[model samples]
Target: MESSTEAYVYYDPTKQNAWVDAILNGLGPNKQRYYKVASLQLVTLLVIVIAKTEYFSAISEVETTSCAVGLMNMIGNKGGCAVRLRLYDSYLCFVVSHLAAFTNNCERRNQDFREIAKRVLFKHQSDPSLAYLSHAWNGGGDEGVAYLAHHGTVLDSSKQASVFHADHLIWLGDLNYRINLSEAEVKQRLAVNNYEELLDYDQLMIERRAGRTFPMFEEGPVEFAPTYKFDAGTDRYDTSAKRRAPSWTDRILWKKPILGREGLTQLNYNNCMAMMLSDHKPVQSVFRAQIRELNRQKQSATRRALQQQLTETPEEMAKGTISSSFIEFDDVQFLEYKEKTLVLENTGQVVAPFYFLAKLDEAQAIPPWLQVSPQQGLLGPGEKILLQFEIMIDASVSAPFNQGQELSHILILRLENAKDFFISIRGNYQRTCFGVPLHLLSPMTIPSVNAEASLTSPPERRKHLLQSAKTTLANPSDPPGSVSPSSSSSSLSTSQQANLPKELWRLLTFLWNKNMLTLPNLFLEHGDRMICDYIRKCLDAGDTFDPSILLGEEEDQTQEAVGANSVIDVLVAFLECLPEPVIPTQFYAEALAASDAPDRIKLLKDKLPPLYRNVLLYITSFLADAIQYAPAAVKQDRRSCIVSLFTVLLRPDLAYKETNPALAQLKKEKLISHLLSIA
Candidate 1:
């Protein structure tokens, strides 16, 4: 190896000018040469690492320097110096330390080594784009280790990654660990050039075996003589009366690299015989470390892959195609469903990844009739994947579509850098509401009354509440249930009341409660049951309640109805009872279309019968008016409820289709848009 002196200047802190010559002298003839020199405690020890500017700039490096106290005052300053570097594809960390010295003090030397190990923390400067590669280590047995790094300003200096976080680690310095033998014994072995025998008494080796020092470090065989305790200016051993035993104190070691893929072969491990500086002979080792060379083609491919991942623009992701733009099912039997698969092909030059999102940012875009899997994923170029879609007709879901409604959904498929694609999903839903009314499912409704008067009249309803109150007051000890009936207030028998739809009594009770039902525990405890019953009742009614009840009547009427606490004249009242609207308020723009449409009745009737269309139109108009009075928060909640309810109610089975498929499709689209709006 060729050697060149960049600059030759010894540092002496005791002098007035520690940097004896011009600092610029450190710059060699090659202006591209860069170097960093660090000193410990007034230049007691120095660590310097150098590399060509181009090479340094081409790699990532993070360095940490710390100093500890070990030996006599001015001579004892120590600590390891470390640098974490990424050369090509491999990460490497190098550490150099000067530990406590002297004979028979291996334990103290081990302690010094530990101090350096603990305090020499590396400040990793990892690339943010490669963040996913942070968890790079996945090994087994004693080699098992994991390293996680991130790009951020480290706030806590005390917390940093250790030197072991790299794929390779090299630790070297004047460790100051002496031999565990007498001077005579060491000389006896050295006289015969028996360095191997002397190594048996090596303090570093003994300390390591006792688990008091470097644990998993590996070192090459030391065939040469010890490099410590030599007479100044001579190749002879210490000549003083207190002759120090020759020990292999100055050394180099490293933990084996991951997978042993890279070998650290010591080509030359020997002591220098020429230049003499102090009482210690300078030791040198020539190593031929095997490094995995980067393959240009592979590297280019990797860079492309990473760059693609980093720049996730929709334009790139939009380059894909679906086997079909729409998937339609003729029917989905209640309580039963079939699974269908749709293929997505990556037709672009680059890899494509996509995800399914809710419609218009609603919590749920897919109707109850549909269930999808693998919400999000990635695809390679020209690759195809089958997405699963199952149509499930749950009884709870069926209740909302009790009239056998059509199920239509415009599902959104979003690509990373591309415009979103809409997949039309059409299916017929079969309705079966638990095969019975809500009254038959519970025990409290057996004695309820039949409110025969125009269900839309408040005065008639008030009379019923008064009669019920009187009847209840007549028996003050009766326990009040959420839907307990006022048996004495009506002419119906227990069986007759039980036979009526449970939703009827529920609505009546809601009217009796001054149109205010505390529903905090409504659907939570008995999941889906309450929602199913409410939906079933709404579908069976074929009628819409009067909006005036919820929007508020005249002040005189409000006062008069105080004790009356009656009348849920409009189906909108059921919507009012909900905390969050079935259709989200954000979609109010779509819902408003229903009310503003000049031919809304005819349009609505195309999908629903005249009775149902009129009912829906009335409710739609009421929602538009309610928006004017409802608070912002209430509007948001109601919007979600409205969408959810209509999503269930507006099924294709309920639509009166014409012979023309295009017109049928147009009618369906109009109905969906109108219903989704806030009208």
Candidate 2:
């Protein structure tokens, strides 16, 4: 509705008053009793469908906006209205908007929608005390809530404004996107009940494909006929001289919030085809949106407690604590899943906003074996939330801890602008064959395959595999002599490799390679050299490697499973795949003896070939470098593994077993310390 007095403004409440009154009067007594006006702005209206008078009374926090973006700001009036109300425990947002109109102005219409979206803001209108309490509980007041909402929720506050900060967002209005067909062609399609065929040419669909409108919104199929360009009081299409093509102008779309009820399901979406008071028929959509129902009485009690806690002294506010200072998982069976809950309570006055932060210098914030939920949140005073801490040592999760070392970890939880709390979490992972050396996997002393082994051997193995398969099928329980040794060896290798999951296999291969040659060799051959360069570039620049690429397909799943991320996740997986340390399980005593041997340096040097020695030295050095990227509290375990490796190499079991005991003890401390320092 254009303003009669001012050409600059399209919203004139004075001019809309009479129309509003007429509409209200037209709604008969029965209809009037069922519906109440939630908002009315120039030419745009929002009405809540209520079953009873008490229903209308439950609604709260009404917000409205009218944006004039028409020519000279006089003809078009884009308006929006949003109401925030709690449907049980779920908060709902109902929005309505009117955008710019015209057949070929879809881009302009999109701009109008964006403007309305940015301008429409909903103010929380709950109890003043509760609102303040929630904000306070958010920890940093408004600032804290805003920050947490950005990091923990789907809504991005740093980007353009949006009304998606609700449990359910239902946007309804005249979207004004038209059909991309001529009037005659649109009618031809409509006459044959081929609405689905017409949808591809729908301007709204076209704009969506072009990424110009409704990025993440979902709307029901337009099974019903188009609602625009109809004659008043009739179902006939536009018969004007300037024939307007039929278009689904008025639309109802919605976005289900990420942090809310299950989701929204469409019950019915169709047009009020019979009513034609204007050129546009009305569109109505009924949705069965899931709402979480909470006990109001219990919530009120919690709020009261929160309020009481808020008024305590600053000293009390600084004193928050968890149910226990340490959580001991004892022993989690490898490749088995177990979960323990840690109850964190706000022991101090005021709200405590808490989030898990990885050690600043560590590549991964949390160990892969441990998974935590609700990475960040706020807790009211005396309020306790159960933090689920899980240990799942599958091939992927165990790859990093494969070395023969005890599984012990310390987790740090930080409170908003407060002291950090340490939670000692430790678990013993069951042993597996994944990370054990080839010789250690079975009693057989398998010869090492040289790096110089023919690269074409894989194809040869495949050829032999076919024959091996035929032999097995021909005689199900054949004797050992039935298959040739090479064929048997290939079959055995294939079977063992197949049993290991993809993640674990890669990890084990990386860890067992005494030298760090696998990476360079693989990349130098098959992988793109640019990727290698990129890694070098990132490292040289002191920039963190992009884990998104390393995790690849596992990125999303891993992030969903664990609260932490690391650039060396793949490397860590390799470590976890080890069933024993680089130095075998029964070699600890030998390692100690070697560390004490007189003339141990020469003895150790003579035991390993130059190639093997270099590889061993490389591995130890690489591990030592990797420790800097590990969490501060967990670095010691990594160092222990490295030291064990160094000990085994410096004091070879064969050489040290026969050493003079007195002489060994004499040089033990100094030589061992020197070796450890270097390692």
Candidate 3:
């Protein structure tokens, strides 16, 4: 009941418009930003967008006072989190909290701290160590929230034992109470309260009575000074005695001296950016300290889990694992493949520690190595050794060094020739997911690789572009059963040659000067079987002609191939043969769809019938797809192609049921079902 999702929650798409409006007005990164931009809608024009990202950790601020110890509640979370970062041999819960109210309900304050601990415990359900990271939140300044006000159970003396006993507790918040308060003054203050609330706010105490949290207190003057101030003159702060000095808010209480058992102890309130971010001047204390119990616990737990995953087989670690380290990387180093350098380390026992590497094509192992490392000494039970190496990498291996360009490869290396060494590196393979043979090091690699040109759209958009080209050539009727020649055939200008593919231009020159519609013979119409057969004859052994051959030739070549006076070639030329752009979008889609060399063959060869069928969907699918398949690349052109395609596909043109119908009607409920059936 304390925390529940409200109806019409943030993700409801039904209220999408309203949500966008609200977000544009105000927004937040909830749950530390795991749920980012789940919805992005353009609410208006002429607006600016700013982006902020939050990664692993977060900081919180709360009000408190009347507490002697500062607190920081280290709640463990599961985004690559852990416990056990050993600081100075002692282990303490990694928690931080502001001072609690020196008030009536000590039990309530204790419960809140417990709740924080529980939260950390729950966040890391799988961690084996004692759960959570907690620290005392303390304060000192009179300007900020007072520690003894409402929830200051942290001060309850009765609960001091358990609080002190907690194994890994760190205190780093404002506490109105001071460690060096005069004994008489401390005694006098306690007299005002009864039983000190048996609840003890007992999470832990500054010092004195303590049980387990921290086994033994680190001797004398360990806890001291007022973490806060009361300066009414500043208006930002108030000055008063009971109103201040005793504030122990910003203190870091550890089992023993943290940095070096013997080190200077001073508080610096300047490390934090105070004037702008917080109303109170933040406090920071540095003890040339070692790690804390909770710190070790968290760190150990996280590293262990990551190491565990690295050792798992792909089948075992199919899903992604935590990568605290990966987040810190600048850019991934993609190494070029080397034969001798590629060695896999074996981690399994009873197997002569196989040191074999894998290739891009092979899932398990390959003949050539992707990586190479000096042989690590044999690792047997209780056998420990570290590797030290220095090898001059030969430029010939990748050629990047030799050629001054880049070369990339996917190679897996196992530690000690282990099974799953370099498992984390697998993600880099997606960059080369498409099965293609890349130049080991192209001579022109550094010439700035560009993206593939956008596919020439189905002639529909610039129907006029082609029409204008067509007009340059004089028209000829079916020359009485053989393409009829136009009176101006002899006068055909150079412009007419510009429109046709090279091969078509040549063949057209030999054919009668007839228009494509009513070729010389009924069998010769552009789409008629005879014309195709004739073209097939020219392309194959006979005449060596086919539809694809025509499509493949360049415009200038086809134009010249289809010269004006031609009799036979004019009737069968490729440029003049394709169905008009008014044809169904699906028809163009098929050509675009099967345009890929392999897919088209598959379609032509019936390799994947559905893809061939799916081709019917796009007049021209996204140009991004084309760039990926091309021998030549064109980047920006592909983006423009995609933008134009989205606009055109949505336009009501020739009806193409196979592809667009599904897209237009694609709702969440029906998408998966339809995708399963088609391309």
Candidate 4:
């Protein structure tokens, strides 16, 4: 066989490739350099069975010249050629072919085309096109049938074939041929081959349906159109159209194919698959041709895989066991190591030795979080070995890979008998603009870069840094380029506090708090501090800010409605968070106060949403703060709104569904009122 070079066409960044590289890297400087020596090799080969079907060829070609496409040409050098692939367990190759004005016409009357198709079918072990097995077209008998030399025949397999059947063929196509068998002719034909209408369209009785054998669909007496069109702007007997005339030059043939055609599919079209790259439509069918033995092998392999998962438990097998303690590595990067830092001391004394085989998580194809080990090997007892590596990553990975997001890759270092030690093999995330840490950007004040030029009206530090940032975002390159990573914290205009959306805002806030507290708090006490901050900021300044600018559209002189369409509801809600006594007067006044400075006005208006939200927060905070000391009227108002807020929380996207204490706070705030209302 003069076969072309085989190419896999798979080069994605999959873990298998990474595993191979890591294994090689872990062999150490000498061994790694030795692999570069090009003599050693590790390889595993697999002949994969896959279903490669034209999943959508049928419906897409509806407006084509034909109904079903059949018998496309096949070209392959030797090796029995190639045929359509199928799933492992199925039987019968079902095909729903569409019609074509030019396709399935047996264009050239010779064995050449049929031979090509047959070769292709046998090579890949697939079945025939659906259209080829339908009722004879154009009054022609089953004379046009084409079957492969070594493959099964027929195309009706998908429809009538039973599970026990090998391949009952079904050829679904626009059979442009009209059948005309007299009572005697029908009997004779029936006797010769089991003849029956593949699929019956009303008004096309075998005898009455007989037409110009070329269009087996309908006759022109009822103004039926011809089953073909060659010229443009021609009149048709069927329906209306421009440019080209209309015709029903489509058809489907039927019979049982030997190979499996389980998920046979179809679509109507003017052309067929024969000329898939042509101006006409094409037919597409799915075929499953499994030798029973092959089917058993594939099924057994699949069952074993599923069973492995179904029967798995950490209690069984080598390498290691589970534990939460961190193993000490004197000189180790933990990420990329050329040696196993964990030398299993006293292997005979210890009862087990295990290591993590793979990471478990719900991550995208290539998550940014990854730790690559550069070296590894079995360690013996009583050896204090040196394993060195670096923690490599960016801030994105260290958004702390938890269990759901990731099952937490605690690199299991198992000492023979001791419980498995888990080290967080997560990337070390570092983020900076130029060289300045993003954390440095967190504080509310920073010095002006141009402080030397203007001292008399020296700009405030936060304002200067903000203006500098605005300038940087606008024009990344400074006219007079300058940068200083050691710069101090800059002031924030309350809301650019974080440009993150509320959902991400919550995450960003957590990250910020983590940087502040250096630990995930016990029972989220930081949440209390956070809510208090929100309340203070909201009551004092939240309402003063304009949400119209931040959350919605900013007015543009040229385009008045060019801003985003957003309601100030969240901002408004923030105002309602404040304590009742201070809110109606203090916060509301703060909200409505006019700012003469446009910048200050924008700033203050922007503060309004947060302020309004804090009104609600403060009310809740007061209940916590005042305990039972609240005034009767104020307490009553809080009681009423708390119930309403709980009802509002039935919605999904808002604050309540959150797992944080905030959601619990909302729920808890309503608990007393909930009982009273129910009572």
Return the top candidate by TM-score: 2
Instruction: Write down the lDDT of every candidate, Cα atoms only.
Output: 0.50, 0.52, 0.28, 0.28
Candidate 2: list runs displaced more than 4 Å: 1-37, 43-51, 71-76, 85-90, 125-162, 209-211, 291-293, 300-679
- Expressed as tens digits, the lDDT of each residue in 1-679 for candidate 1 is 0011110012233331343222325565754455442323223444444555666645655454554433211112444556666766566677777776568556667766655665466676554343323433311222313211111111111124566666677788888888778899999989999888788778788777886677668888787778878788888899899899988877888876655356477777777767576677767776776544456787679889988875674444347877787888876644454666788877786766788778665787556556664456677778887776766655435443432234777999976666678899887654332332222222222221222232213655535544653443244241322122232222223443343344444444333331232222111111222233434344434344333433246544333332122222223233332222333232233333554574653443343322223234444443333333334545544333333223322323223343543233334345544553534
**Each candidate's TM vs. the true structure?**
0.39, 0.40, 0.21, 0.20
What is the alpha-carbon lDDT of model 2 when measured against the actual structure? 0.52
Ranking by lDDT: 2, 1, 3, 4
Candidate 4 lDDT over 558-658, as tens digits, reads 12111110111222232222112111232222322321222333343233333222322323332232213334545443333334332221222222234
Q: Candidate 2: minimum summed lDDT over ten consecutive residues — where?
A: 482-491
Which segments of candidate 1 are over 4 A away from where they belong? 1-43, 69-76, 128-133, 137-159, 209-211, 291-679
Q: CA shift at 441, candidate 4, in angstroms?
A: 5.9
Candidate 4 regions off by >4 Å?
A: 1-283, 289-410, 415-428, 432-679
Total backbone collisions, model 1:
45
Residue 530 error, candidate 4, Å: 38
What's the alpha carbon RMSD for model 4?
A: 28.7
